[model samples]
Target: MNNQTITNTHRDTSLGYKLGVFGVVITLLWIGVFKFTPTEAAAIEPLVVNHPLIGWVYNFISVQMVSNIIGLTEIIIAIGLIVGFFNSKVGYVSGILALLTFITTLSFLATTPNTWKMVDGVLTTNFFLLKDIVFISISLLVIEHNKKYI
Candidate 1:
């Protein structure tokens, strides 16, 4: 490719990457804030309660508190991701955290009861959890991009 073409391609890729990162950051921040609400807390109860690693949290704390804690963690991760835009080391760590977040979310597909069902001879699962696959991919890309600077 000519110099101009290569430069254009690089610019386009960078824009796409920025958009993906922005989407993830927005999603995490919005969901994290929503977790503080009673409705969101209740909605997530089933998933949290069923989680093997985090289910025990409910034993010592109220449902709202548990949700609050998760929400706070998500907010922190989102902030870290934003900062990662300027700091590669922070970005690498934040990307890893974001990756783990989605992996754990995807695990809910298996851990949560009634998450999967057979519909009209087709196997269907919680479509919401499926979105995490894209998030995971983005997180990986973020990690890869930042790794060059670390």
Candidate 2:
């Protein structure tokens, strides 16, 4: 027989977990960086304007200003994720932030239907937005895997 043993630590030691975390970290960092750019701000205008939860932000602050705030928050969360890898309190907060971010992203499906163009009577979403589902699962896994085992 082959030599392979699956245990509770499977998820912790599997390649999927490492790669998933790395990908999530990279994406979050990039999202944080993009929020500072003019193009990114302009690009997100539609999403912010259409969102029912936070769309009112435009009424109080300019899109660029809001974009900057989001960017800063994302940057902080990214740092938290890195620290969480080592078992820190901030890492816990990162898990919360990550979950919230993905929730917001998934909300886009209900808030902004235009983003998902209709093709052959099927509502098809862009890979960029749909990818949040994957991140959501990853964030959950990270939260569980990083928890202290005592």
Candidate 3:
């Protein structure tokens, strides 16, 4: 409405954008590092076991192996995203990874909703998977905002 109000709004949105990128960097890097560990690999076993899209990875490679690859990729992507903060090209690539990661995780809701369990008819999995939606939204925003640079 007013110039001052518009300026404040713009500033707030900019801060939110920066924070979102930082959050994604921290979260993905932390989780990505752990993905290589036995604990993290075991933790995702059930989710992977029931997954329809990528579950077959276990059939070709051991779960641990698959987890290792995923972890390494995440680390690389995290690095790229950090670079993206300064370099739009790298950021674009990391943005693609973020989009794919969240989309895949969200797909889990449909492929293996049973893993999340249902109580009173509502799937508990929705709660767990819903977080991906937020992450995806952040990724989408990052992508949209970066389109000008790309």
Candidate 4:
């Protein structure tokens, strides 16, 4: 293709990608605020405090400010991901936030000690751990896929 045509094609692709990323970020943020429906209490029911380390982590993460900050930062990162589409600096920041989120999630899960007693005897903690893994994977995907556009 001619230079003009090639440049136009690239611009269109980049614009489309940026828009798509922005849309996804908005959807995720909305779901988190509305549909994810985090209760006033934590998602995991408290396990019997049999382990000291687990107990310590659990108590620490339960701080109101800590949880609130985590939630707020999640929203901020969503914004960053949307804006990051237009600039490399924002994209890198978003990636860093995602990594931080992964770390926080790991600590949250680890602190809980054990899953609630399910009637069917299914271990639910594994499900949460898997979800966190998926979150990390998506963060990586965002970083990898949009690095070029950013």
- Estimate the TM-score of every prediction: 0.89, 0.83, 0.82, 0.57
1-150 per-residue lDDT for model 2 (tens digits): 112322343434678777887888899899989999999999888877889988899999998999998888878888888876654355656877898988897887778747767799986775687888998998887777656431
Say which prediction, candidate 2 or candidate 3, comes out ahead on TM-score: 2
Give the clashing residue pairs of candidate 1, or none.
none
- Per-residue alpha-carbon lDDT of candidate 4 for residues 1-150, written as tens digits (9 for 90 to 100): 256654553465466556555654775476345422345224422421333343455455653333354456667888888765555567667867776666555665555544444557764555544555656665675676556554
Error of 4 at 33 (Å): 4.3
Find the candidate with the highest TM-score and give its number.
1
Residue runs of model 4 more than 4 Å from their true location after superposition: 1-28, 31-38, 41-62, 116-122, 126-129, 146-150
What lDDT is obtained when candidate 4 is compared to the true structure? 0.56
In terms of lDDT, model 3 sits at 0.77
Q: In candidate 2, which residue ranges exceed 4 Å CA deviation?
A: 1-13, 120-122
Candidate 3 residue lDDT tens string, 1-150 = 356654553455477788888888888889889998999899777777778878988988988998888788778877877786666667777888888988887787777645567689975655766777888988888777656565
Question: Going through the candidates in order, what is the number of backbone clashes in each?
Answer: 0, 0, 0, 0
**Residue-wise C-alpha lDDT for candidate 1, range 43-149, written one tens digit per residue:** 99999899999999999999999999989989998998898877778888999999999999999998999999999999999897888999999999989987866
Residue 73, model 1: Cα distance from true site in angstroms? 1.2
Ranking by TM-score: 1, 2, 3, 4
Please, what is the whole-model Cα lDDT of each candidate in the order they appear? Answer: 0.89, 0.78, 0.77, 0.56
Rate residue 109 of model 2 by lDDT: 73
Tell me which of candidates 2 and 4 scores higher on lDDT.
2
Evaluate model 3: give its TM-score. 0.82
